[model samples]
Target: MKQMEDVITIEEKNHIDELTGLHNLTGILEHLRGHDKYSASEDTVIIYINVMNFKVFNQKYGFAGGNDFLRGMAHELKNIFPDELVARTGGDQFIVLGKSIDKEELLDKLDDFREAVHNYEKGLKMKIKAGIYRAKGTEEDPVIMVDRAKMACDDIIRVYDRDNNLYTEELDKRNELRQYVIDNFESAFKQRYFQVYYQKEIRAVTRKVCGYEALARWLDPTYGIISPAVFIEVLESVHLIHRLDIYMIDQVCSDLRDDIDSGYAVEPISVNLSRLDFELCDIMSEIDKCRAKYDIPKKLLHIEVTESAIASGADFLGKHIKKFRDAGYEVWMDDFGAGYSSFNNLKDYDFDVIKIDMGFLREFETNQKSRIILASIVNMAKELGIHTLAEGVETEEQYEFLLNIGCEKMQGYLFGKPKPVSEFVRSVDCSFENNEEFDFSSYYDDIGTVNFLNSTPLETKSMEIMIKLPIAIAELHGDQVSFVYANEAYIDFLKTIGAENLDRANEIGRSKERDNASGFANILKMAESSYNQRSEADLVANGYVINTKVRFLSRHGEKAAFALVSRNVTAQKEAHSADDYSAVLMHLLNLYNRIDLFNEEGTFENLFLCGNQKALSDIERKAVVAVQMYSDTHIMEADKERFKKFFDITTVHDRIESSGKHYLVDYYRSALPGDEDRILMYIILPFHYNGKWRFIAGCRYMDELDKLKSVLKQIEST
Candidate 1:
């Protein structure tokens, strides 16, 4: 009998198979709900696994045997899938929601789960195979995720029915092998026993060096250089990915620092980040620490995270991407088009650069559709604020195709192979031959150093910056759209959105009173709004269909003088709206309020408040500092003590108020000796309104009571 405590609500309870305590359809439904929580700038991974021959197993072996087999498989999965959504999507099929677990971990767990199922001898003689596929992301529904995972799982299970790596009963041996790798990994890394190689990207025109991609090389001193394909699989099995990633980053960083400081131009180096690292620790902070230790700028360091890694049915990667970008480093998504939800990933993940896969480029020029796809990729990337770099660009045709489509930056064999630090420096620094015999060193005198640091005739660097700025377009009354001063990025954004592109139009604001559909609606709306009374207002226009942000900057708080800044977050905005916790909270607030039933008036008062005068003073000081971060002021530590000395213990830390309001204000201060100009700079308001955090922090600076009044009035007006 199910106990009273165990009888949970259907939604709250784990969707159980009832006969086996395994995942039911509810798991998939719930996993879909989680997809909405991720940031608008991230993709969610859904691996659908379909159970094979389940009906036959039940018919041949009977319900008891089938149930027993299910229980055994569920037990095996319980440990491996603690954080994942383990849903039995179909009769025997399962869909695992890979929260932030890497693909490698998922593979190993699936293999283990398969093995455990095969070992169920008490149940029946049966084979369990599954296919796994990820979501294509045309839709963000969890059902799509389940469908994809099921497909992918089905593919693997169909051919390798049983007695194979995909499905086996050798659980003990797998565990043993995993443990051995764990034991040896540390020693292998210590010995620097790894194979590190590099692939080069060449310039189709000059035949000069562009850049090289650093590939890891693991050489087992005892057994010879370990293959990355083999060792990486081993690392994944032991769950030591976080450590391995950190090791690679540290090594690359140290190597780059040594080479660059010694006067080598190793423009930038990229290291791959894994799911294990993100959950285990903040990789950005680690990078920050590394940069500080080596005296490196954050911008020089770049890290690559897989699309699948960031799109794991949660906003985990999106937030981390923002954090990394904020810390001043470029973030790139590796293997862009390999995944089905690649387009969704592109929109949601804020990648600084997109490295075009070489496979697409190899035969694109000959195929019309492939060429079109290549062109579209370039255009889309440009529109979305990302620079495009062609990867595996070995052929000159590929390089030419990229350049023709405005994809200038590239990395592959066309440039040069990745070499040791000493070798890379020599390769780029030395002279090279260009078309028909023009040496690169001699050409540099004609093409390089254009008065960058205040020289006379070559030209100014500032002008070069201006050239890159988008050409602005002015939106005036009907049939008068004209060109204005904007940048390339802005121009591309406008073009992508199908905003009418005008050539040779004037670049000035308020030219004949704005009259376009967008401008007219905005201006009229502003006229009808409260912001008309003030000088400025924030306008958040949600273009739901496009999933973009159109922000128009006006004069002051009012859309007066300056123009608007528009951005397309279509992939995220369209999909992200439903995931907003604040929006959800806003909807449920009234119901929650009815349930909580808090009183309007506060219960505490002066003297009875927690902590003594000294404690209150410390809190007040912190509040003052909290507000001071914004205030253009500095209260020296010595000055604080010096001021404290002026008041007696009681006078120094007594509470004050605006008068006649219970639970309204926190501790305040009166004029101190010899410092009458300084008034209380902080207040800890006990009574808070609405749902805002109470115990409010504040600041006040006044000379005299009347002066304070006048100053407050000025603040109120502002």
Candidate 2:
């Protein structure tokens, strides 16, 4: 019997880890199988613990120190949770099983253990994160509990300064969402939820499209639209980013193949390559496969890489970039000046183009320092024998500045926002002609003969003043083909559509249906030769689709002055809404004697509306100061008191506190002398903007205020 007991002890010892003397994975499973899990009256808690930065710890202290630390940690955990199962599940990770401990007690114990790890013997310090799952005694599979704990731990790891987390419904929902993505990613691709949009890059000097950058967008069936900012990171975590990246490359190649087949002029379109793409396989081989499969020229497809990606794998990137150049592909280093080692990257690697980040141009108008820095970067890039592109150039001033500083290319909203490939192709196919005849015989006959060029110098100056008003206006010579004068609005409008001056506008705005300059000239000449007729004509420019009505006036000496009233019809075809929401808000405000719209942060959208100009100015000043300081405590005391009464309501709080809905607060304010006897106001709207909360509130003094109050009451009752 003694010999048999010795054999049993030896077998049990074999199940324990040699280094930490804790149960190995198999032993842990065996121990769990022996538990009367379903009979436990109290909840059983499974904990997953991970040592943070363990790899770095091992690098600094070596494997011997690492092994010693793990063994000590296992012993400490066993002592802390006496009579519980403690096991080394994997590298730098441990699991604990216990019963009867609630969440608060478990968190306290974990916090204490974390602090203990920081103060271990010999000053050997570490930090750990933990996830807890409380079982309801009905679960049969221990693996399910382990996975839940691990998911909780991963959630904690993703956030900073967070140590331990308990599994909750929200985490369960997020896991479901991730699983859906993992399972349906291929289905989504097949169903065409994934799409490519192109943003055009134009030559700064010529203001003509030179290339395009391909951008990916995802339209999820249930979520409507999922931002790449959210989904891409999830995909990267699962090592599936390469799949999406390759799909995007294939789309680019297929588009180019069709464009070439149609015999259209081709532009180099660049696709972004993530660092993971190179890690998975040879990037060049993938590119070669796509190019060969599509039968497109290598030069038509460019490659773009971010600064961080190159910096992380400089040696590999350098070799690959050289291969790209040798194979007739241009390599662009994107988002330059966004990091500290930008210059170092440029020095170490070979790149055909450098794209300056858009951030520098954001403050170019106000910050002299930004201007100086941008100028320095442009000059340095010019000296380095590399082409430079200024990205995010949204304003005319930025475009002109980049042009003057010798930036080879420019891209941003100033040109146009990115659009779907189908829409972009239509825009590219927009063709125009400049040779249509115009006849004004009927109107010219009515004009008979008017004085032509018989105005005094003062009169001419007055006409100039009229033209220079905010409205778009232009003056043409007798021929109406040559521009005599263009007002500021006209010049600005033309520039907005990529035309430099009236001459360029005439050149680019020509269409097959009409000759813009010639048509106007004919109208003026016909008016001059007519009998009491008023001659007129209409001109249209495609692409920008500008429409202008021209009226010809002739003076006594055959000189003609034409007035052109222009409207940009592009907005009618564009996606943004032109309806004035502010007008509706203003009308709502005027119904009350005095009103104000404020965000939750106490910043006012509209000041006092009671015609108290002084009060409005004072409140506006205070509101601006409060927002600048990022504090609600600095707002006027009376305003705070009024707002507090509204926020204090439970229903109102429930609606606006991270609820993504609006609530209303109705209150009364006593009037002063000469004011209305009764004043009722409302702060009934809650909203969020730019990651902050806001509200809309105001009071009105009207006999009909009670009617509006009745309407609001009806809404609430329903």
Query: Which candidate's lDDT is highest?
Result: 2
Question: Which parts of model 1 have CA positions greater than 4 angstroms off?
Answer: 1-183, 195-212, 362-367, 422-718
Error of 1 at 145 (Å): 30
Which TM-score value belongs to model 1? 0.40
RMSD of each: 30.0, 30.1
lDDT of 2 by residue, 456-492 (tens): 1111221111133212223344443544344455577
Q: Which stretches of candidate 2 lie over 4 Å from their true place?
A: 1-17, 21-87, 94-142, 152-171, 189-193, 202-209, 218-243, 261-265, 293-295, 306-318, 333-348, 352-417, 428-718
- Assess each prediction's global lDDT (C-alpha) against the native: 0.49, 0.63
Error of 2 at 419 (Å): 3.2
* C-alpha lDDT of candidate 1 relative to the true structure: 0.49
Q: Candidate 2: TM-score?
A: 0.45
The local distance difference test score of model 2 is 0.63
